[model samples]
Target: MANTPHGGVLKDLHQRDASIQEELKAKAETLPHITLTERQLCDLELILNGAFSPLEGFLGKKDYESVVETLRLADGTLWTIPIYLDVSSQKIAEVGIRPGAQITLRDPRNDQALAILTVSDTYQPDKEREAIKVYGANDKAHPSVSYLWDHTQDFYVGGSVQAVSEPQHYDYVADRRSPAELRAHFKKLNWTRVVAFQTRNPMHRAHRELTVRAARSRHANVLIQPVVGLTKPGDIDHFTRVRVYKAIMPKYPNGMAMLSLLPLAMRMGGPREAVWHAIIRKNFGASHFIVGRDHAGPGKNSQGEDFYGPYEAQDLVLSFTSELDIEVVPFQMLTYLPDTDEYQPVNEVPEGVKTLNISGTELRRRLKTGAPIPEWFSYPEVVRILREANPPRHKQGFTIFLTGLHASGKEAIARALQVSLNQEGGRSVTLLLGETIRHELSSELGFTKRERDINVGRIGFVSGELTRAGGACIAAPIAPYEEARNKAKETISKWGGFYLVHVATSLEQCIKNDRTGVYAKAQAGEIKGFTGIDDVYEEPKNPDLRVDPTQTPISQIVHEIVLLLERDGYIGER
Candidate 1:
């Protein structure tokens, strides 16, 4: 018999002989009852070289030259039972293929028949069925996760998997607050007129311009609501994205624009997504929503086509304006104009402004190559974000996030606490100032609720790790709620050095100081659901230390925190 590339595979298969068949049977029996779309099945067939056909007779043989390499499974070790791509037979007919015909593939070794598979006879309209089918052992077929993972490296600069299916539905992590809860949040504030800004990507000048314009036009309070969920293919994950947001948050019109995560999946259907986005914002209590060109579009399609025309999504939303029960604010694409040295909408930009065509792909190439990302695409804080991302090759650290409102003394208190910890010079203390850690830690997690939880959760985890390693971490964030604080406490306590130091900054002083203009903007009705204005701020019932930003000095606050740590035995050595 002539030798073939799969000769060794066949030999290995034969070696295990009965064991191989038994293993295969077991794997098949335990195989997840997964189904696939017609296209997905076709793709699988292409990948498998037709050994497992969606139509017809079983018993086919094909050489998967690198099956062992692809999966760590050995020959005769019973890899997962052969899975057939599932598609509607009607679709099969539409494609002009004969139904119920057996398909075959050539076996690389001796042209031997080795395996045969079948396809589902019908489509499963049930979503739960689809979810189960998509997640199988050794199957990287979670449609949403797979799609994003497949394309993220191509589109998102320095992209990496940030978070997958995680929960943060309780009040400790997110204050358990909902859109309906906005009414009771800040009893003194008027939320009658609210504008919610929508973003699937991190904010830049262009986003700022659109939000500013929208807020000005509506004469309403702006809520900077960004999604932190599984987005379109190639989009950055939500975990890191939230950190980039937190860094530049001080720039947002404080109190007027509060940031929050939207736990929703992005279909990237362009016009349909825009319509869907509007409906969601409305459900979340937004009176007005922003829809820009190609809103939620998944970029170009096969044949190099833009999924929907620039204005298509906007037009569709406007058509259903009344039905959506929310006002539509259409925005043009924002471009960086060199003349003004800033970003402006395509329509209003001056002719003299030089155009900097910084595509996301180009930016990612730079990041991957260790090149400096132009400031026009993202903020300096975001640059830091791109750097700190650890791609899970090893679990050496955790991400710890400090969250809270503006002028909440989070940064100042964090600094003082860091200085105190630094006094333990021998210990490997790593202080991740929220603003500084955007590049390394926050780049992967996008601006979604799940992402935020992961980001904040990582922060807590890291702090706990450092403390356990005989190091100290002083993370100061306007971690305003109980859920996030609880997560930190839990993570750190597990490591044996847990502390929740609440930097108490009263809403009155935060508004009066007006360093960021956010509070002033909220009062002027330029923004809504401003965390301290329109959104609820749940105070810690009891904290290790409470530093009133209104009256305490930074030094005193830091000292008090250190004392608490020492008293609790979290100081000196691990």
Candidate 2:
């Protein structure tokens, strides 16, 4: 939900409300006057769908006009400030809006629409002023996969228009600036080289020592960039982590470092993530990104050993240096030397300096039980961060992935399996076939590649959800190729007992039994690049159980799968 792309909900709403469509087109026509482009228009439509649909009826009579006026005020700005709304707020007056919408800011004294004000060149001198402008999708979705990180009028929002100083839309900044923008901002301030620290956890002596070392070694400014959105399960929440960052900022070298939020998501990948982090920092304008041990790691696999060692992240960055302009500054694990009353790298400590090594897990445990972290473990400032980032440990579950081709009877097989697994009793079984989830997850303007990735990603989420609930998942998606199937296999296998049941339906038979008429469309070029016809569908070379939908009855297919699970020790014999 944190990384939810805007406009997905608006497109859905526009289908039901003809007025919204008219309003969108009107805004698009007027958006350019306010600096909104064609792309921003599309993005605004999406953001409307994602953010404002549920509140359609709740918006009062005067609110619509306020929205329109807000847009008028935010004219010609490349970056549009989003009109922030609180659906939970009681009064519509308490809510905010941009131009093109019929809403006005609430007046507390009069309990009526605030007097319409002209757009100001400066930030809104009045605290209550709002602005409306269409923000570009690029700004809404920053840190793109490829290059091109510019702080331009690419981002917009739905709200009243006000002066730049006041940020007329929402009262608070929706999010912090992107890394690229931060670098540009600092560069303007005369800071040339920056050392960006990537963190999901709070600062401790080890982290502090490494960061300090990075700054000294690289001769660069330090940027404490912490992820503020959905990290791996059990990680600390954003609010608490921000407080920790605030507390520890004073301890850092003055004028040599600064703190900011990285409005990005984390993928618990170790080596790949290291490369990703480096690239992100490069975009954010960092000259150097600190690659601490096990950087961006998700911990152990099923074997309970580390997925990658600390040096692996460093190695991953070194492996791809020329491409990513950012330098990687790697530092060994830091340990505290009590006798000397200082922190030192594990290798640098003398045999006599009362040395100690305390892990993050141990630190958290002590905190949860209201115990003191050893003085040698972390700085008092750093320990304050640990206190702020203390989150409850959550036990995650496993996911079951099912893949095959369209019309390979994937849905039928998935449904049958779901029923069978449910009948097994005591085990929670949830079936998420491709079609149903796609309808719920996908958008009209969604790109083919993103759609494909998201479709598969949703299946993975479902699998993780089902498995975590201590239940089983039966996901049947037309994976179409060995690569996708293998990815599904690998992702699910991480949870253990990931039975890859390949629904081996012949391509000819699938075309012959086409339920959605996709095959016919593919042949006529009506549907470009359809799988198994114009495109290829690689059959699974090896699957735990291969069922020919043409030959096997649905009942028998389900029984065989259940048998495989039981035989493989995933389920008890029944």
Candidate 3:
């Protein structure tokens, strides 16, 4: 029999009544709305769909504290991760949020209302405690901890949510299923024992070996559950990873494996995450879950130490096995045995026998260099899918973002680099100059800080698309603020290599080279909120490269940048 769901019930909260849903939709329009971030949207979807089986809404203060401190809910149910509805103070005031008030939760992507929350409590979270307790580290190197401190807002509003409608996902609609739906699916398939595999990465040969071994050992079918929502930075996008997953399905034993997409925003909270994953798999009707070494672990902290012990995930999951309902299947490193032409556990291998293993880093290096991945490491189909998404670095796309004061020669160098790239004769090159963007894309925006950030973000968006399509993007924007520039870098870095070049032209030099006379106008009060005049410019503390255009000609400066790109594997030999 399939394992029971967490909390003994699937908490699918979507409104069933058309009239009530319509009424709620009507009321939601009148109430102030809070726009959910991508992570929160993922959480909301899981909540409504019962994938987060017991969570009907974001956690209240007591539940939040309980989950953080005890890894359980207020009702003493085993729940590891805390779901939050974090919002800014400005948003709080805009919504007039209070204990009794209702706030509509809207999807920013489509401007549609998804749920309504009766505000139970609003309070500031002790992020340090959250980081330390939930992630076992208050270190910024942990992606979730960094998000808590940096990207997350100041306040957390908690309540029970009433679903107006389920969020629509157009992509891979067939594979997305609620907990109840998936349980029904398991029943229909007559699979008594199901072993779910949790993955956020592309599956290689070793992964297939371990999963197949797990299923055969347990006498269970395989449920390949992969995260489709936000994962760690620099991870492959879900679209590409899904294609990779789809390609690998045929390699599994016939009718032995099935694919399902989990809209989960991973915390990378090693042990806690493993427990949480087991619960989710249980809700999905899986009888067992495979917990490998360092499952869901974020690599390292800034202190050069691992956040969790090597086997902590397996240990923690084992500790919660009886309560988790889903069986915990422990896994170890599988090595390829050339002599037997199969994979075996390291401990089972004969001493002095030749073994082959490819590390994830090594695989990525091979992909970037277009090096051959032996069939022992991955299937040819899987390799082909990965190569399509991650072409050789020389054929890949890249973005060069130049930031400095106005008249800082950013535009000059950008145009020169654009020409140089054009002469190289491979991919198309686009130059997004500050003045040109302001004139074309952001005509209505002024020189205010917010407007400048928006302008820079626009350039970043366009650059990301171009980079994704395998073209060179040169964006010369006076991206004065670090936060916006960082946002831009985050936006483009997912698609291809993103380099932030600080055009280190001094304020005095800018004034001297002011052919446009805009800086003079700003200083003379003719232009308001002009950067480096009425406004302050924050110098980049960690730029990829810094160049002084005053000290070198544009051609030489472009050459220096080309050399940097070549060094970073963004380009190849002339």
TM-score for each prediction?
A: 0.41, 0.42, 0.87
Q: How many pairs of residues collide in each model?
A: 56, 59, 0
The model with the greatest lDDT is: 3
**What is model 3's C-alpha RMSD?**
3.7
Ranking by lDDT: 3, 2, 1
- 1-574 per-residue lDDT for model 3 (tens digits): 1233443212323424667667768998998888899999999888777778777778999999999999999888889999999988998888899898999989978978888889999989999999999999789999999999999998998998877777888899999887787888889999999999999999988888899999999999999999999999889899989998999999898999999999999999999999989988888888999999899999988988888887999999898877887799998878999988999988888889999989989999999888899998899999999999889888888999999998899998999999998988789998899888989999999877888889888999999999989899999988999999999999998888898999999999999999888887888899888788888899999998898988988899899889988897777763
**Worst 10 contiguous positions by lDDT, candidate 2:** 119-128
Q: Candidate 1, residue 382: CA error in Å?
A: 2.1
> Residue 488 CA error for candidate 1 (Å)?
35
Give the Cα error of residue 348 in candidate 2, in Å: 2.9
Candidate 3 runs further than 4 Å off: 1-21, 401-416, 442-457, 476-491, 498-556, 568-574
**RMSD of every prediction:** 25.6, 17.0, 3.7
Each model's lDDT: 0.53, 0.56, 0.88
